[model samples]
Target: MLLLGMAWTLPNTLLGLLLGVAGLARGARTRWQPGELALVFHRYPWGPGGAMTLGNVILNTGASLEVPCRTYACRAGLGTEPPVLLADHEYAHVLQYLVLGPLFLPLYLLCGGIGVRNRFERAADRYAATGRGWWPWPAPRLP
Candidate 1:
């Protein structure tokens, strides 16, 4: 039974490693310029008297602008910085979308086994709605 369990876990471990490598490579190729508004990483659950926090920001100079974000709870007692982890997690989704292009949405739904395509979006909305500085910033108004 132990051997069988190990065999089952091996494939997943290898796949995760491959995905990590791919994400790192993709991140290396992408660059952000100054003065471009982008979403940064924010950690902190929607709880009473929580403060808003952000880790990083995404930016672009040209017309093409995309930011993808997601939220997930970290294991208790880990004591790691939440913003960093959230930034990595959200950026991974954005990277996947960029690398995979249109196919990303479909592939994500298929592989994630989620019933809806907006599952991630919904989660992001809920996180943002908590008012911990998750509010969407409208386009900058011009005078």
Candidate 2:
């Protein structure tokens, strides 16, 4: 299943690798996170100081798994503190990529790109703060 997911998101993952490699030339560092099944590139010099997830890759301006903003930090227990769950948020995106494959990009844009209004981002934040609700759409009830 992991392999299938990887293959499903290969296109975006390749693009992520291309960008990540470029960041490496400018002092970025990468680490393979088996748990998340993603390659994280930290200290990426090009962003406006935040993280972006493409398929199974995460590009971070500060440090990997650190929240890019203070929006719900207090609620998440990461208010001006260490151990942020930014990784978990981005992991939600990875799950989306796996399920949607290449369609994730287009659908994400259609859903509002990135911001509070974006269901994807909102869901990701929800998952980070709480251990559930990662799926952007409501879960189906069991019979």
Candidate 3:
């Protein structure tokens, strides 16, 4: 299943590798995050100083995942905002990428690109908080 997912998201993963290579040229370092099954590049000197997930690759603006995950609490507008682990949030995205394959990017943009209004992001946060319900599309209930 892992190999299948890697193949399914190969295109996006390739794009991610290109970006990672560029980051490496500028002093960024990388590590394989086994838990997430993703390659993470940190200390990347670009972007808005956060993390961005591209398929199985995760790019971080800080030295470690915790650095960016702890930057701000992941609040789902539930009155009380609790800290959401960025790693788990990003792993949710990887799961999304696996399920959606190449369609994830286009569909993500169609939803709202990025922000509180994006259902994808919300679902990811929910997954990070509760460890389930990552599927954004409605699933038929099993009888």
Clash counts for all predictions? 2, 0, 0
Global lDDT for candidate 2?
0.80
User: Candidate 2: how many backbone clashes?
Assistant: 0
TM-score for model 3? 0.89
- The alpha-carbon lDDT assigned to residue 29 of candidate 2 equals 97
Which prediction has the highest TM-score against the true structure? 3
User: TM-score per candidate, in order?
Assistant: 0.26, 0.85, 0.89
Write model 2 residue lDDT over 14-125, tens digit each, in one string. Answer: 9999999999999999999876778999899997766888999988887667454443444445445333377787888888888888988999999988666678887787
lDDT of all the models against the reference? Answer: 0.33, 0.80, 0.82
Ranking by lDDT: 3, 2, 1
Q: Give lDDT tens digits, candidate 1, residues 1-143.
A: 43443343344324433433343433312334222221321221222311111112322222233333233322223333233223333343443333344444455566453322344433433343342322112337899
**Residues 7-119 of candidate 3: C-alpha lDDT, one tens digit per residue:** 99989888988999899989899999988879999888799877888899998888887532431223444445566778888888889998888999999999988776787
Per-residue error (Å), model 2, residue 72: 7.1
In model 2, which residue pairs have backbone atoms overlapping below 3 Å? none
Which residue pairs come into collision in candidate 1? Answer: 40-56, 41-55
Worst 10 residues of 3 by lDDT: 67-76
- Identify the runs in model 2 with alpha carbons over 4 angstroms from their true place: 66-69, 72-84, 141-143
lDDT of 3 at 73: 24
